[model samples]
Target: MLKFAKYFFIVFLITAILPLVLMFAWNNSQMEKFHNAMAKSAMSTGLMRLEYSVKTNLKVQEGDILRKLYYILPNDKNLSHIKNILNDYNTEVIQKPIKTPVSFYERKNFDLYCVTLVPFDNSTKGLKISKPVSLDLLRPTGPYTIELRFNKDDAAYEFKNVAFDPMAFGPPKKIFLLLSRVAKPHYKENSRREIALKGEDNSNAAYLTIELAFGPFRGMIDSIFTSLIILLVGILSSFVIGLIIKRVFVTPVMALSKAADQVKKGNLNFKLDASSKIEIIKNLYENFNDMILNLQTKEKLRESFISNLTHDLRTPLVSQSQSLEFISQKFKEIGLTNEYELAESLAKNNEHLLKMVNLILDSYSFDPEKLKLSIEKADLYEIIEDCKEQLKPLLAEKNIEFVNNIYKGGTLIEADLFQIKRVFINLLSNAIDNTSGENKYIKAAARFEDEEVLITIEDNGNGIAKEDLKFIFDRYYSGKSLERKLGSGFGLSVCQKLIDMHNGQITVESEINKYTKFIITLPLSQHPGKGTKEQP
Candidate 1:
């Protein structure tokens, strides 16, 4: 039972589980790689958005600086209104500055509301601005100069200070301070002050780091678990399916195997009880029944052969015994004077025994391998002429007319000359014996086709029955003989065997009471160097 289970398990693994497992592993791995790549791409796209926002903000700020400069130098009322409009624009459109708490500080002893405009410069070029100088005093009817200072970098910018309501420009000091602190740690001590004014520098890098750590990493974990669960479900389903298939299919096969074993042990009486739903098993069962029927047929043939052998042997023996008894009684009466008559009787019985023994030997020689053929290149027409001449005496005794149509140019074929001559002789003899009329005739013809030679011997004699034609070449098959005497029934079988040896063929076409024609076809050469075998 363990052996049977092991066999089924191996089959299951090969046919079902192994393929499914490999596919699951391969698909799961690909899904994992796909999820990881998707998460990484999403994070990269988000970082690109942040960088684009920063660059856009810098462009807006540069435009604002240029507008402010125009308003100071020209002191145009139109320029002042433009600055007011710029201040009303949303902060998101300008830059991504930090949101900070709004705070108000009053400068001590300054009657002029000291509105400090933090000079925003993103350039790294070295330039300096001195303390405040009156621009109107220098140019008369122009803007005043305001001092801008960076305490850490010791850099200052003196820009024209135009008078306006500080309330119009919202307080950006708290927002700037918060942005500066966040931005400072990313730069060197000396560069921090420069970078603080340009708020676009370090904001993009911080957002990219946050997205990678939080968003994509969480997605990777979720994708891994999902793929693993799918793989587990596939494996479990394959196992269940394989188990059910083994029970349905393998069980029937095993039962058949056991039945076969019992049959081999000489138990032909055993019958299989395992009925299966599989088509293959059903076919096997039918074939097993056919095998048993064939075995029974063979046993019957064996018994028949033994019984026939006894009857055949007894007939000849009984005839010889009666001949001996007659010869003894005659010798006692005539006192052995008429010796010649006694000798003739003994010779007749001896000839009968000799013929039986020769028939048995000829049956053995009908084996293809046992017959030694003297194969050579010879004229097939010449061989047919020789056969006609040798059998002329027999034809004359029967007053039968012989017709010869040996083809011109004499067809050449490579064949066993002596064996082919014997084939013709046997066919001609059978024809002579079967012919009945005084006008009995035998027609022998030869023709040559491309690559092959054909020789036919046709007789206007009593033909064979349709049912008897099929078994005519079987050993010892003698159909209704016209003479009512049995010749050894091995002639046609010998012809078939010899033709097969030469890689040629023999066939008989006959209709009852019409005529029988024997057609033999041989190749142009049967050289030992060019041996051939019969096609299956």
Candidate 2:
């Protein structure tokens, strides 16, 4: 049980640790991917914000003052009047703009405006204002023209004479600033743009630098820490679970191991007190008990075999020795020239010895491989006939009636002919020996069924007991008492082994004091590869 527990612990340890390691590795890889995506998104959002700030500030500077004026005006002007008013305002604002003084601080209040004009009549619509507009207004009627205008010192300037170009701003700040911010020692020329818009009096420029702040690093760290904490908790939980399992399952198994060791050392009385809650441990306990029972049975059989062997050997020896003594005494009483009587005594002793030796040899040769058989295609009826002929003298002596019921077409079977003949002879002899009553009879029959031949040998003898029938084919297992005139207990066992070698089977049916039947079935000249008819 302890050994099993140790192995289980090792398995649990490996199972628990491997997944955590894999999770940690996977977490690291996923973290890297997440961090990369966050970084890219942050960079993109930052760039978009920078562009939006520039456009928004420029629009605010341009529209704030003009929108106020447009809201104040009443809608009373014709197309020509509106154009002239816008043209006059543009000239006034641009021409008088020297009052505010262009400077870096004041540039925040500056603006640019763009306008597109559409004609009320839809004719002569190609005319667009050529000048860049800080603020633009449209005339509401006729083939109208777009006008760019801006305010300075409560006066508006309109650039009516200038032509509009899409790139008329001349790099934005250069047209408006008076000085370059990059000319300062602390300013980086490539890192930010600097411009000076030329004016009649002064110019101003401010650097617009692009800088990126690390936003996702903190988020990345937080995610990593969270993942690590989750993984740690999972690993700890798994370890605790594994430990609990080992205690509940492994401990009982270890107990079984110690008990098994005691059993191996011949301590059959050893018992395990381990908890039976575990199915494996309970199964082990049952198997251990069964093994002990089998061992005890084997020990009893060994003792019986030894006693039987001794008795059998002693019987033959005593018979031979007594016969020799009787012969010597008879010879003295009769004459030295009595050759016939001397020969009879000698033959009787030799026969007893031969019978004992043959029984011993038969027991040894009951092994299936040891009995080499000459197998061939032989007629089942012919073998049966031969066996009957050989047992005819014995039948006559015992006054036993013999009946043979062989099929019309002799059943042909592929088998070891010599071994099968021995089988038939043994069965017949066993029946003859056991037969009693004045009308003692034996019956042998063969019939074909479903591509196989079934042979049955039955006799009107004292039938086998129900208990003994189960073990009739066991080695040295004679159903009859030892005192009976039966040969060695190997006959049925040998027959069973021989039949098994030919891929055949034998069965028996018997009733006490009525009859005993031995049924043998063999494939009729059919190999295993050859298909047989299905039995109904």
Candidate 3:
């Protein structure tokens, strides 16, 4: 059953949790993809809008510069060489008119450079400007905008761009390095799509190029709350499902198991109510009830047979005892010791038979419901002596002496005389039987303690085996050396039962091949009445 429950839990977890786990995994992967897609989409859309905004700044404007540079271009041989190259420049120095007619040289690439000379203007007289004009003021643009220039010279690219910041979600923002990695600049046509990265080139024009940096999006579905919600739902659902299974299946099976244990212990008088809606459980209960009914019926039949047999046998045993007593009387009148000894043997046999019949009835009917003890006040000393006399034939046969060491004056004890006498007879008889081959002596003695009478019966005979001593008084139990004189195999059990009836105890101490002692403790003033009574 334990193994079954473990398997049930394992299977339940697997079935219940598997789909949730897969769903969570899929959801997580999709969320990551979505975050990336949103980042690119947002970047592309924002960059397009931003470029239009930069274009609409309304700050930079183109103007004619030919008249200002006409003398320098037509006369100077160095500037006349690349007239088209010189024409492309929107030169602020010529328009703003700075001191010394500042000559600017741009490295086209390698040792080749585009050097242009702007001599004094043809129309304007030679004059140096009073104040220095800021180059940034001449060419205006926004903070995010960057402009780069390229030439066919030693230096391929002229650095004119500013660095971008890292990505940040809120105030106290940090630089966004999301699209800040520097890669070899390549031109691609403007197209809106999800990309691995985000950045823009306003035009493919050479010499001067404008770049706009955009970033990836951070989206909502990639949050910790989504995964947390999924995890919590999965765990809670698994536990709830487990509990439902336990209540519906495991609990009922365990209860059914408990019922089986009671039946195993031979208790047939129990009511098992497996009144469940489950079909199998209902059928199991039905079969259990039937088994109990069958057992009860068979037990009744067996008890009835034994009860009738014991009752009928007792009558004939009484007649035989009478006949034997009559023969013994005749032999005694003849003063024949030899014949009297034989008579004693016959009498012993008869007594043994009677004891057997009574033991059989006691063994069968000894439950609390059927047990009745005929209580009375009797002398302990007389009971013990009578028990010894009852076994004299067997004692003589084995040449075993019976010593009655009980107090000379009788001690009045409250007990069931019949039951108590049987206990003494059985113990002494057992001692005599065991001592037969060894030619040993049997001693019976008694004394009074503060509140109990302790009677000790011991024999110098092959004692009970050590392993057998513990269960020697259990019903139907026999020691290996027991003589089976009572033939019913319940003599010691009956002895124990009778002593218990008087609110007393019986114990045995023994050593193999040495001696065995039976100690019976009876209350000195056990109030004389049946402690309990019932009908079989």
Local accuracy of candidate 1 as per-residue lDDT tens digits, 307-357: 466457757766776777677677767778567467556755665565455
lDDT, candidates in the order shown:
0.56, 0.57, 0.60
By lDDT, the better pick of 1 and 3 is: 3
Measured on C-alpha atoms, candidate 1 has an lDDT of: 0.56
CA RMSD of all predictions: 21.1, 21.2, 16.4
lDDT winner between 1 and 2, please give it.
2
How do these models rank on TM-score, best leading? 3, 2, 1
Candidate 2, overall lDDT?
Answer: 0.57
Q: What is the C-alpha lDDT profile of model 3 across 2-61, one tens digit per residue?
A: 788888888887788877777766666666556556545544654555444333321121
Error (Å) of candidate 1 at residue 337 is 20
lDDT of 2 by residue, 1-536 (tens): 54566677677667876677677667666766665565455444544554454445445533442443353233432445445545632211221212211211122233432222222222322112112333222211111122222332232333221334331222223411222221111112212221222221333322222322222233444454565677778889888998777666666666667777765544566766534776877787778777877876785686568557756776776677667767767776677657646756675667657556666655553445444455577777788889989989778878999988876456777877677898999899889888866988999898878988889999988777777777677665666643223356677877887787777899998877788899999877634422222212
Candidate 1 regions with alpha-carbon error over 4 angstroms: 1-357, 407-409, 480-488, 529-536
